[model samples]
Target: MSDEATGQDPAVEDRFETGPIRPPSEAGSYLLRLTRGCPWNRCRFCRTYKRRKFSLRTVEEIEADIDAMARIRDRLAPAGVAGGPRAAVRRGVVTNDYEWMVANALASGGRTAFLQDADSLVMKPDQVRRVLAHFRERFPEVERITTYARSRTVARLSVDDLRSYGEHGLNRIHIGMETGHDPLLELIKKGATAELHVKAGRKVKEAGLELSEYVIPGLGGREMSEGHALDSARVLNAIDPDFIRLRTLTLGPKIPLWEAFHGPEAVLTRQDDAEIAAEIRRFIEALEGIHSRVVSDHIMNLLGDVEGCLPDGKADLLARCDAFLDLPEGDRRLYQVARRAGLVNGPADLSDPGVRARAEAVLAEVVRTYGPGRIEEACRDMMLRFV
Candidate 1:
């Protein structure tokens, strides 16, 4: 039914906008589009904002979106005391996309919000402040607001500006420090140097904001894997971000990085699950003097259990990687197929009779489809689906 028929304002639905992606941790947060696309979308491995023009939404436009969200929240507020907004959605009372967005957030407790496009900090500090102020005014219940930012952009901002943003309710910043190795950074066209990453990360921490630094295992392929691991640890140790997220690399034909993996002049070679496991082990072993919690929250990762607080849990994190690495060839291949197929979480799951049987079944199917020697290739094919 139409908005008019449902007694809902059409303008409220029209003004709401969202971006393409958010961190896996922000699944429950209300996504607010502060920008249309990534300001710096040149990274070879990224296809998130490809072919899309980048533009910032004006403060007035952002306020309008917040106001629309507020209208939906008010409509759904009474529903929360009963069956909740999800029930209202099922009854067709929350029929529109905008209403559904608000409903999902309300269902998740409406305690967090994530600003979108890829680089929200690229906007003027004062403009971002205004948007945050309006959002807080509308949703004072929100406890946290986070956004993705480029190291180059964050480095450009002063500590005072970052602190001011924190004071205005933007509490967390997620930076994609894919690899701290300078050569790997240039090869990926990340548009930021190792120095810039450190500078930006330190500034965010210094400003009293929670920081999540994302690192991609196997980002350097086999050629620079060692440098990738050590340098990434070095950078993280210097910054000591609140979270160190592990997002293993998953490349396909759609991304520009795929070309680097093929051809006679190929400078990069893709790493299989086993190689990535070893690299992650090295990366974890090198981390020192930091208290960041390591997180492997993404499906792209081969080992979901390789997560823990640093310093104390460091050995445990390495042992998780070692457990996978220590497995025999057949067992490793079996676990890889099972993990990529979403049949198991880690190598430990294979010890369970039911899980082992399921994993064996998945391994047999993968070998049957792709041939025995091509198990890694089949796993890659499966991992690309998540990407």
Candidate 2:
């Protein structure tokens, strides 16, 4: 953490030699930035970690990290030497560790190391496999390796190579399909076509690995709400991934899209609760074939479990949408208030007096602070987290 220990710029806050690191998300598991900032961070919707350059951790550097971990693990063997804990030993591992002991303890625990930055697979297939092999040698117990792969990147990997990775224990790949709408895709400069997304997704399927594709319901906003859903549905209908993650958009400041939205030539867009709901509906309505669960599990999503198997659950999902739309304006606002305040997930029974009162209180305060401005601002911020 000190300057002497890390020759990195004082301005650079968090740097890693290897192992793993990530940004938080509702999706399960931690991210190991394989590349750093996104390969194409110019997308207006994202600003979370785009303030840096993209680079790779050299093979030698990664290997040295593995060695350091191995050495650290050996240094912390039990003090009694002949395979036994001390009679007085209790609680967690002892605090007093020799230099070697510290290394040994660290190495012993280094079983699951995620490749860093964004697209670690950007490296040659053979190189990636060798890295996987090295990981197996240094930390053999690691069974669930993963990476954040760009669809374009995954599309480039031949089926044989992708399958080989699956065999080698790289069990999952996360791709941000964002929205399946080509117009929307172009608006945000996603750098890949909708057809390309389908190809990449199918390749993941062909590779025999779990694929989690993110869908941003509100990316099109009211301007293209129906198109957002219909096109996205068509795309997902084609790919039929194992999981379709519902990422309700949350726009934040520092995102370029915000500026574009307010600019004279604003092609930027966002969806409100009702418009977003309709967008989701159209998306679902367009679905057929390719069994994918419609998930709204993320907190940002209005309906928490609007998720289930396709075909069989399609009508039920539609009925839920009808139920929501039919609610009186006050009732609809009630659900929105409850959702944004985290009082409840989805449109649940606000009939409970205590829950209703709490939601009302939060809404009241929100109204007081930003007045009507809050709604637009909140929508903008939500847009930033799109897919």
Candidate 3:
């Protein structure tokens, strides 16, 4: 009898289910989901997994999935074959999860994996350790593993727990710390206080784990822009995380925050591109005595060209920001139009006559369709797609 006919279970394959998103840096890493959704899904600006329910997978189930992944990895290994590349064609092995996993593993140099769902760090310390141990055992080649975390959750973990996590190979934690201004945090319903963010960041660093804090540039909008930048810098300077990533706010229509932003009594007034650039400039200026690397990895930022190590690269980053801010209004508008459309990456492109001409033509067309004043708003609307 076949294995299926004898009351024995058939061998499982492709049991893994990835969540909706992961960090841009994790594009080349294998996605392993230990949780189903965000445990605290109240952040107004975020829409990821909002429509889904949060549930943690049991240790047994997660181990089974890991075992399945290991089997696939071994089968997909690029080793000796009789007929070279043609052997794969003869075997009729079409690309699926196994093939994609192998491709990503090769792309990552066989060194990294990213745990998925919004807050995998919220898992119980013992449970997380088991998962980490299983990963290390199965994929001994992987050198780094990362996950998103909530500040309050990290703060709640005891020092011993965090230390064990590090020892078990939890190398990095990425936290979406939208803003450090308490009032804005409350307004945006971030659920965690600025003090909690500081504590959590310090805890991660103390455990010898690298921390990446995601900062939403226009999160506080116009009213709190100054305080947002200054206080954010203050908190970051206090903890000095390994990376400060730029994720400028783009008010998506589906998000609850959009209603608050568009309402007449709205407390938050969205900042235009130029205004946001100025705010980021102030934020960078306020950072002091920290060794964090500031990254403008997303296109929503008005100045994608701005990035460098703090203290050492401060002046250069500031100059890059000013390079865009000081441009002629028409030129700035053109750059903004091109940047959002994926036509240009940053300020460096403005120097190229071909890029300038293309952006100018696009801006002219936009101006014809909508008035001159609508250019910024139109670009903002396009930016929502990235969110």
Candidate 4:
């Protein structure tokens, strides 16, 4: 169909793309796809970019996308100023995916942007600098620009290069340091060691960029939970990142980690909610000499409320974990069911009678269907839904 016939702008529509996922905190930010897939897609616990080949978009291509997004902003700005972007969309004024992306970002104040897909820093340093400069020129309102990068990729770049990126427009880098335990890193094929993670994280800090290191609470399974927690804490202590985000592990049959749970030679045992909470407690306790904020922002995290600043909030974070652990067996199970079902945030929610009653009802139904012994399995099934 002709563009005139369909009322579509091919320049804007065909020039840009978005990736599959972004951090939960970036729910409102504009997404700019700099790469097509993960540079290292071999992590067994991750299925995000599997089967897709990684490729970098050129400076010209990314600039084209920035231009398209700016066009979208210009088209939607009047409607947004009159009422709002959402109202415009409801009234059929905002048309096309590109317009929606711009509208969403505008509605959220248009202060942030995230570069995708996996390792954006893998692009040439000069190219990244040019892209960031062009992006700032297009969207000067964006105050924070962030991207996902592998620790190994960050390690490959000199501190000067990262600092230059920061000087351009980039503000933060999020690294998936799933586990700092050597055996678990190898088991999951994370493609980097603990030492490399520390090196990369330190370099990022030295370059004056905010860093968020993600740690999977159950990446080591039951057998190596202690080592996972302790070693991860050791690594974080060395790096002292700006943010320590907890993303609990959730495995399904499609990912290679599933093989560790099934078949004759199975070597790993999945930890239940209680076991994971204990491991998290141990991990939090092991965190020392770092001022990073512990964030439980993801829905997959069972203790979604286990977040606080370090040093001062350290005791409180432990108490929050203990709050869940100290609940009666039945109450703990009820809270687990409620959390997995999205009915409640954490054990603290159960203090309210209404929330407690609702959680009890959910627990009863889960017990009736999955049987009391399999409540953990039911919770695992629920967690898989988020994955």
Candidate 5:
């Protein structure tokens, strides 16, 4: 662990899950990479950040990154404050979470910081605190900090340590909850169970820091898709985090799932993404009480763009899914084309007849070029994401 204050490397540093979080007030938010990759990278259905190894970055390294961001924040500071720049800086300094911290830091002449690697929290609490303090002391303007944490790490930690970090302005955490089904988790070699996921989520909530949970559709596959939906719902229902981000399963090279599919005689035939849509529909329908905002921001998900207030927009969301299902098979293929092109994902609108026709046209070419068997090939490629 390199102490930023002393310019010495700590024995270890922070790591991050390979993703970013966007806040509504994202103008000031910073993406702190706290974890390197998924510690349990063996999941059959996952590919995001799986190619990387897990590591803890040094405190100095993380602080240095923050210091680099401080310059930008400093320049923007004068604009956001209502009163004079001094007042702006003062208010910005007190915000405990990262966005506020960075924004405030910019206003206050402090730097905003984002943690790196995978599990930053894996560092000793005192070490993390020192890093935060050094940032605080040196920047005096950085008011907030954030990092990613695994359920297992959160569960293993004593709450006081967490509370201390929060007090130090280590403000937000993102948890990857791909699916909550225990059997599915087992299939994927996810390190934590549904219970641990909740325990970690609630602990973050209890600590008074912001939390975002990620869920990936189709990880359970058609065989266990229903269980994936219901069981994942069960897990989220317990935590009810600030956000439940959507990440649909997409394939890449070297993912273990592809190996499984090819190995022991490829038992699972690829679903036409209609199954992916169905899985999303089921997931939305199953969600219950708790004010959680669902987000489908990634291109890999069939409903990658579909998300809204849960259980309330649930009806409309499902209706959208039904509409997609109603399209002619050719039109459905169009939507799939759009999905691959990153033009469309999610249960959102693909109503433009032209877009659908275009999708169909594209699918025709794809089929002509690669054959229908290519879907399986694509799925296999997606599964290789971990390697």
Candidate 6:
């Protein structure tokens, strides 16, 4: 029936809450917001939720959202926008604004869900368990439920609390762990020490949770680059996380980390792309016998082909970085601009005539308009798009 006949407000729509940030792997999962913002917002390099205040959604409010999601899923099921309907579903009839989320989830088979905001594990253990239980009860098909967490918080939680979380179907945790060098961690005001990262990582792993620890390659800049690479490897070796994600540091004018780097009382000296790639290579070489997957998936990274598992694919990962570094200076510049502009994936793309032409054209334009000195700067600035 039309809004006029049913006396329903046509403009009113179901509200599905989502946080501002999530891991790259969670792109296809259902975004279930449990918190409003980052509780520890003092990380200088991160500006994800600077403008917003931190708060937790009450258990009642979160449950209301879960109920709303269930209703939306049900409404979209018959329409074949969710739950893998075999028949062709007519899409024109579902006019609600939130139906697109269901449609996207249906495309992926809807088996994973990511809890949102910077850290959802900061909630009370009983509260977290109840929310997880409610979520699993409502959607039994969701096989994996993951969330971002802080190392200090994880360290403080009792083993029983973490195990209970696992029992409630909380499958994974992604911790920043940006740098393991104490000075660098202190410089960034991460509010967690290297020891905390090791302890917390071990605790989570012991709880039978898959841990993804993110380490930033250029976080320590030029002065502490060596320590950043070696010490980070040391920490990762100690924890032996399931995933050792490489997030190459990218700074912008708005980021406090950048301001600090450029300030008179600078804490870090920024490194160029080549230097950062070399830093990554050093980190990879220093890694010893840890079974973790290294992912350089983001565009901000100078090399994209460096993903592989440790103790097995480590040599190939090293060769990928070396190959990029071995490229002729002129070709390297062309490839850097191409990668930053989203024009190519890796050096292999340069073999394609069409791809090479596009990259050369972009390189020529950058050199002509901005001058040779500005090419690197332009590429670095382009990274802001991904962030």
Candidates in order have lDDT scores of 0.89, 0.65, 0.83, 0.89, 0.64, 0.84
Over 252-371, each residue of candidate 1 has an lDDT whose tens digit, in order, gives 888898888887768988888888899999999999999999999999999999999989998899899999999999899988989988988878999999988988988888878899
- TM-score between model 4 and native: 0.95
- TM-scores of the candidates in the order shown: 0.95, 0.78, 0.91, 0.95, 0.73, 0.93
TM-score of 6: 0.93
| Model 6 collision count | 0
Per-residue lDDT value at 29 in model 4? 88
For 263-329, candidate 3 gives per-residue lDDT tens digits of: 7757778888888989999999999999999999887777777889988999998998898899888
Tens-place lDDT per residue, model 5, 266-349, is 544345577877887787787888778888766555655566776677787777777777778755655666666555554244
Worst 10 residues of 3 by lDDT: 1-10
List candidate 1 stretches off by more than 4 Å: 1-14, 81-88
| Candidate 2 local lDDT, residue 364 | 70
* lDDT comparison, 3 vs 5, better candidate: 3
Candidate 2 Cα lDDT to native? 0.65
CA lDDT, candidate 5, residue 340: 69
- Write the number of the candidate with greater lDDT, choosing between 2 and 4: 4
Model 6 lDDT tens row, 1-387: 111122222233356677776788987777888899999999999989899999998887887777777777777666665433222223353444344555456557778889988989899888898899999998898999999999988999987898889899999999999988999899899999889999999999998899999999889989999999999999999999999888888888899998767878786788888899899999999899799999877767788888999989999989988888899998889999999988887787898999999999999988988899887788877898887
Backbone clashes in each candidate structure, one number apiece? Answer: 0, 30, 0, 0, 43, 0
TM-score of 2: 0.78
Candidate 6 error regions (>4 Å):
1-13, 82-90
Whole-model alpha-carbon lDDT for candidate 4: 0.89
Give the alpha carbon lDDT tens digit for every residue of 1-387 in model 2: 111121223221122353223323312221233345556667777764577777776666656555554443444444422221221123233222222233222333433445556667887787677767776776666666767778899998999999998877787776878888888888877888899999999999988987778888777767867777888888888888877877766655465665645567666565568777777777888999878777776767877758777878999888777667778987777677677666766565577889889988866775677684565454344323444
Residue 259, candidate 2: alpha-carbon lDDT: 60
Instruction: Write model 4 residue lDDT over 1-387, tens digit each, in one string.
Output: 112122445463544788988898897788998989998899998888898988989999888888888887777777662354556556776655566667777878889999999999999999999999999998999999999999999999999999999999899999999888999999889999999999999999999999999999988888999999999999999999999999999888898888876678678888888899999999999999999999999999999999999979999999999999999988888889999989888787988999888888988998899998998999999888988
